[model samples]
Target: MEPSVYREKWSALKNAPGNEDALSQLARQIAFSFVDRYYQDGLYRAEYIDLLCEMATSFSDTQFNNKASSALFEIIVEELCDDYEEMPVEIYSRVMSQVISYCRDVPEGVALDRRLTDFGISTFDDLYNRANLVHSRRYTYGAGRPPEKIILLSRVTIGADVAILSVMIQRFMKMFPDAEIVIIGNAKLEGIFGGNPRIQMRRLSYARGGGLFERFSSWHAALDILQTEMPPETEQNVLLVDPDSRISQLGVLPFTHSDNYLFFNSRKCDESAKHSCMAELANSWMHDVFGAGDFCHPTIWVPSGVRLRARRITESLRAAGCRRIIAVNFGFGTNPRKRLSDDFEIELLREILKDPRTVVLLDRGFGRNELLRSASLIADIGNRGFHASVACFEDSQYPRTSHGIIGIECAIGEVAALIAECDEFIGYDSACQHIAAAAQTPTLTIFAGSNNMDFIRRWSACGDTQCKIVHVNTLADPGHVDTDEVIARIMEERSGKAPGAVEPAHKIPEIKPPRRTGKQAKKAVDS
Candidate 1:
């Protein structure tokens, strides 16, 4: 069936009378059609898969009381999995888990274990154990048989790319001086790591906004690239490093032989190092895998033209008598829980503006929502009788306004360059914090939402400069946070009085987990 016809039928059934049997049957049919089209015609429709998953989850037990309905649901699962071998492991797991949860009395012949075995794992625990074993290995490279090419998969997100992959690239350059290093990631990587002659970036796009199964499309492209780079004739002479990349669904999919593949299970490795951040963990993993070497801090090589543009902006700010430039970004990536309330942002801006010589170079973040939020923040701050100027990347000059917020909308590279020029950086637990630390600028990160101490420790910005985190349990109540104390701690870090202080001011008490909204619940299933 065509996509439009299937969508129309699904919508009609959903809106029509309470015929549970009909809805379930139509859902099974659409799912089977999806699997058939994907296998027979190479037409993988993400929307069809999304609809099927939604229907399966939305069905109540009353709908599945009959044997036919239950059998149809089971067929849907088995057919989808059996035909499409390249489906992402995470997506497959999510769908199966949801089905099992709803169908408590699943038939003995469901073949859950058999299906998992097809993906090279007996269970989720087995997957982690295998990853842990890979990370624990301390293999020494043969002195005479270094790989001819090193393929480094991207960590997908900007923050992880900077904190983890950059370190890997730097270490690989030093370890195998003759091997050609190829980076597989998005186009933005060029702006950040393009300047290095030793590293070559191969662009592979991953749809960050696509449906769950849609994300797996990039893996096929990456697989083709790997085949061309590492043919069977020369497989042993090439190395593939997987840094828990989304491209391969965190190394669940096989891209090369086990001997030639190295997966850096970032989440599981270095569990005993409770205080170590991801950058530190990555460095430790490198040392263990390649023997001990000098620790490499995360680094970015901004393009020369981008660097010049950043310098012009900073110089314009300095020419306006702004002695200290502070780069601030409030982007929280895909997780809205990591962000604080608007009042909190306003208060933080107020504190930074207290220094008459400091000028705030605020980033009007990406997407419509973030852009709107940043604009609202600037307006709210201005209502308190503070000077604010809005600027863009195209502007060759900035307003001669000192001790005020200058909101600018620019690219990621521009933000990195500005951070390089800044004396200090401040933001939420987002990419800018990592970028700032990479530039060796003192950074203050106001971490919120999560009380997971280990998570906080693992994600803290790492660099030679001072990187401090102020934990706020905004998940419970943002208003209850001691804004005064938070601001004071930030100022102390700014004054160089608390050098190397990575701990939060006070321990964040454990609170009840927040109930996930409908959209958040869907996102949880998608992830």
Candidate 2:
């Protein structure tokens, strides 16, 4: 539907009593239409943005009592930030100011605002001006006298943490040899990077599916942690690096003194480096800031126990005559646009099952909806006369099938370990793809959603492994996708032959391996 139609629908319901569902749906439609038009025409419509901001204000007035209401507001705000440069400056300022106002009106948001004020930011404008000033200065600490402690904030998503945060940790480790490194984020960081001795994890939970104020509450939680990490007595001796992290709401909030803080605006890319992925962009930013030498590709450190369990699973399949293992994940994490049609997944699985020597370790993705989707996919495969097994990560028994599907429910670390054991990994543009690439496994990523070519370039998996990206414009119509061509490209990737229809991103020639192996790293963690 066009923006005008959505706008009219929203107008009728904007003030009417409690058709909250319909109002929320109309708001979402309007927001998505705005994004689609922006991508298609390469222009931002100020009228549409104004309408979105007005709708967000209305939702906030209701205190975002419902999940749908809060989600609508978040969608609008995120769309504006996704291509922030294209958004008009006045509109951006208005929306951010409204966000601050909305936060002040609620208890959690009030706490968040107080925290920012404590850090010397009296308003949204104040935070942005100070952050921009820091960005322009691009200063680094003295080479001879590095800070005694360094704090790195998590990017708040597993994929970004693997691609960007891990690179920063490695680079910082080298640059400031004696600095104590602390990470502020969820427990998942421990699974991914806990093995590093120099790193410490401080938990600060962000509610991904909560209301707007609930999501903002993490900033307050982050400040509480920072108070313990960097007290006033030694504030100047500590440095905090914000990698455009969500904890700071993409640098909309300040955590430390500007002189002691460094923010890497991961979204800004020059004309010459427009196609660089986040890992590459981060390395370049570090180089420019500290004159740091060498490029660091993405890396992960799976625990030894997880690796051993993954080995047992793969060995069982190998003994059953399956020579090649393929790990696959289809979850897209709250974005339906990122996924292709069910028919596409079914056809792709059928094609992979054609090879008798290959076994597919399919991931039953997180959450109820994804679990049901995977279950249906498995049933569809069985109806077509193929054998399948469903098991958990801790299951000791393995399916002895030579060429079929083994659907497993596992944790993130287990998924990484399984991918590490596999001959190759296949998935959508999700965290598993980044994890697979970091483990040095050849990866095939089917890129869907977003017409933004720059977004695709910035997020392409980066590691010292073959990563082939097949961009399928499924946003318009999934039926238009050539399933046969995609299957052929997958086959080409497996055979180590140049893909005919798809082009692979250039691989980083070498990334120094982690300081310790899985078992050795395991010992360090235990000790």
Can you give the TM-score per candidate against the true fold? 0.72, 0.84
Considering only N, C-alpha and C atoms within 3 Å, which residue pairs clash in candidate 1? Answer: none
> What overall lDDT goes with each candidate model?
0.69, 0.73
lDDT of 2: 0.73
| Tens digit of per-residue lDDT, candidate 2, span 99-127 | 55555655445676676677777765675
Question: Which prediction has the highest lDDT against the true structure?
Answer: 2
Report the lDDT tens digits of candidate 1 across residue range 1-527.
Answer: 76678778877866663776677677667767766676686654655655565554343443433323333334444343222233422344444443332322234314433444554665545654554355455554556688889999998888999999888888888888999999999988887777677888888998654432335457767877877888878888888898977676565545764578888766552334455567877887787677777677678888778777777888877887889888999899876778877767889899888878778889998989989999998887788778887899778565576678889888888888888877778999998898887877777898986786767877888765667787878767765777777777777656655423244443321221111111101101000
The collision pairs in model 2 are none
Indicate which candidate wins on TM-score: 2
Which regions of candidate 1 deviate over 4 angstroms? 1-140, 269-271, 499-527
Which regions of candidate 2 are displaced past 4 Å?
A: 1-16, 29-75, 84-94, 105-109, 134-137, 496-527
RMSD of 2: 5.3
Q: Cα RMSD to native, each candidate?
A: 12.4, 5.3
